[model samples]
Target: MRTLTLVRRVAPLILLLVVLAVLTVRAAEQLDNQDTYFHLRFGHELLGEWSLRDPGSVSSFATADWVPTQWLPQITMAAVEDRAGLAGVAWLSGLAFLALALTLYVVARRRVEPLAAAPLTALALVASSSGLSARPQVLSYLLVAVTATAWLAAARSGRTPWWLVPLTWVWACCHGMWPVGLAIGGVAVLATALRPDRRWDRVARGAAVVALSGLATLVTPVGPRLLGAVVAVDERREFFSEWGRPDPGDPRLLALLALLLVAAAALAWRGTDGPRGPRTLRGLRESPDLTALGLLVLAGGCTVASGRTVPVAAALLVPVAATALHRHLGDRPAWTRLEQVVVLGGVALALPVLAAVVPHTADEPPARPAWTDPALAALPAGTPVLNDWNLGGWLMWRHPQLDPVMHGYGDTFTVEELRRNTDILALRPGWRTLVRETGVSYALVRPRSPLGRALVDDEGWRVLHRSPDLVLLKPPPGWM
Candidate 1:
């Protein structure tokens, strides 16, 4: 019995570790998004003359209203880079993956049988993998998971934890999507208030917490102006592919559909007679995880509206699935002593192997394109250059002296600047004129871009460097 209990206890921990290790390895495989560089640059600047009171713009345009909610991620990644170089960044990414997975699992296990939690967790991971980049949004996912969990706990305990109020402030400073925490808290509060046997005390407490969480968000660098940032994103959503409305082809949608189907089937096939289990409508409505399901629906709706929101859906849905699946299956049997010993031994041996093989420390950080580094090395320092929108952060990071016409700090550039950059890549009318007007005699562009193709035919331009991924173009001898 003791051995079986120990195995049962270790099983969830083992599962969490497995998820963490896998995510960490994935982070090790690559750096993060294009915006990571500009974030890092901002972090480094924050340590210097750049005051938070008037955090000046890094890009070409004046962006006095711009403020980064990714303050912690920026500073931390910069510190890691300064210390351990690219290897440290990989480590941080892995740790965040672990934190997110574990946060979801901790909330899930309360309403789920240990045995059923593992597979459901895996399913959740698969569905959410689309959003698994080392960005501040990752932190938001983790916080959302925590908020979901806390609210579930509150439903059972009848007292909202006051500490959660302050957590909102920290979360808002960490990520732009901090409103997600408020959304989750509101859903939980609403669910509890609407319960047939409602506890008005809990409802009152929940309403207060959710409201407090909202006001706490006002305690950020941007203050109430954060709403402006969110509005700006919504206004310009058409400009970004990630923000574009979700499609049927998104794999996460299929995963969510499958989970929903399973729930319906579980209800339809519930033991049809006496002593009905918790799978029925009455019992499910009373289930604490129902609140989690509501959160999942909210997240899923967001994901359907924008593909980049898969993390929010995935983070909230996994725990809800785990609880529902566990309720349907009921309790599972524990492993025997012999089985426990074998599993423990296997895990012990596996740890060293994973440590040795998984992290390829020598591999270059994905954010820093090595090809661009070499090509840019050949160009003179401070050369005014035109580049891909994605490489803006990389150029600013790697070629500090170069005057990049654009990079990842989107708000720093006007709508016209963004459109002009797009025109250069799309090979639109007057692209050459615009390029010259911007005083860019040199252009570094993705090899596959229409601009590169146009440059190939133009006699006035010469190729200074050519690679499979990038093409550097300059004016011919007399044209310059």
Candidate 2:
């Protein structure tokens, strides 16, 4: 009878684990992180020509003092790329996702039973799947989860976590989204402070943490102004849609909404007896600080306003959901020590089968345009060429001689500069003359672009070479 009961519990756990392993593997294979080549350029620079503090002039019009917002991770990617090729890159990404899975499970298990935690953690992965990649942001996800767990641990004891100060410094050096950590730390602290029975000492400690976390962000090569890179694209938010509002159709957004509703329902009212406190507080018992809910609003608001941050909402709300389910999660069915080991051994044996079932590929971003190479060979070194927004990094890495117009770093360019580049692409008024003004003598683009179509029709710009997707065009000799 006990053996049959263990089977009933273990089957669903195995299924969910299998599903999670497959999804995470597929996510690594399919999504090609578009801005990778952009970072590679900086990474290559770090390898030889320049230090972290000195970003060399490889970008098209590299005037505005640049910042490597993802300096540490980019350097890591470069080192990995040098040793393992792109396959290693995909594998490395798989490892980060694996680490994230372990972290999520440990965090979730603290509040819910393994039966509940497995699927909940799996759901969190599904929600963040859309945004998964080898980018520096991956590191931030890990950092955020770890920081939240640490803060909660410290909050339980009512002591300030001095360790966060150094961790924040590391976070700042790693990614531009470092501010998110300080914001999270602040929210967690404030929530603890608002507890009705909390002493003023706890409140002071929380406040001290928030302050130090903020200061820790300044421990970078660029110092306090490093955060300025985060808002660099604020002037032209229209250019980067990810920074804009979430699309109603996004799979992650739907997953987020579903989980949120379920978590709210689970936490609404529960205890050994009956009715609990506020529904808005994410169902935490005997606490009205509403701190967790406030953090949700900040993360959720950003996700709603900027579709890019859905992963952050995923990272945050999952832990909250687990906590909400704490009281509701029933105890696991009884299993002896040997029975537990059998379950673990069986799941371990199934992993290889799970891996084989999942498809794998090296789908990379800024996807390789067909004609780029032949066209690059045809052009001479130092050619002032206007390139595709996504193409710049690919070109930058493959042939540094071909001066790039622009790439993924939105913060690197001024609003006017970005507008001018877009105007040329759209073939708007003064588009032809604007090319001359910017000293752009050649254009390398997919033939389907508006500028490519215009170049084909115009007598002034001649199509020098053609590939199925890309075209190389040069202006009349006298035009420049």
TM-score of each: 0.83, 0.86
lDDT score, candidate 2, position 265: 64
Over 4 Å off, model 2? 1-8, 27-31, 270-289, 330-371
* 1-480: candidate 1 lDDT, tens digit per residue: 999977776675567556655765576565656777787787787766675545766555323366666677888888887886766666666667666665665555556655556555666677778777666677887887777777866766777767789998888778778777888888888888788889898888888998888888776665776656665666555557777776778777777566545534443343444466444533433334547567656865765767777667767766556545555655444544653453344445444443454356523545334566777776777678877888888777767777787776665555677777777777678877877777776878776777767766764478877778888888776553
**Where is model 1 more than 4 Å wrong at Cα?**
1-21, 61-64, 199-201, 262-271, 274-290, 325-363, 366-382, 476-480
TM-score of 1: 0.83
Judged by lDDT against the true structure, how good is candidate 2? 0.68
Q: Could you give the C-alpha RMSD of every candidate to the true structure, in order shown?
A: 4.6, 4.4
By TM-score, the best candidate is: 2
Task: Spell out the clash pairs found in candidate 1.
Answer: 24-94, 392-407
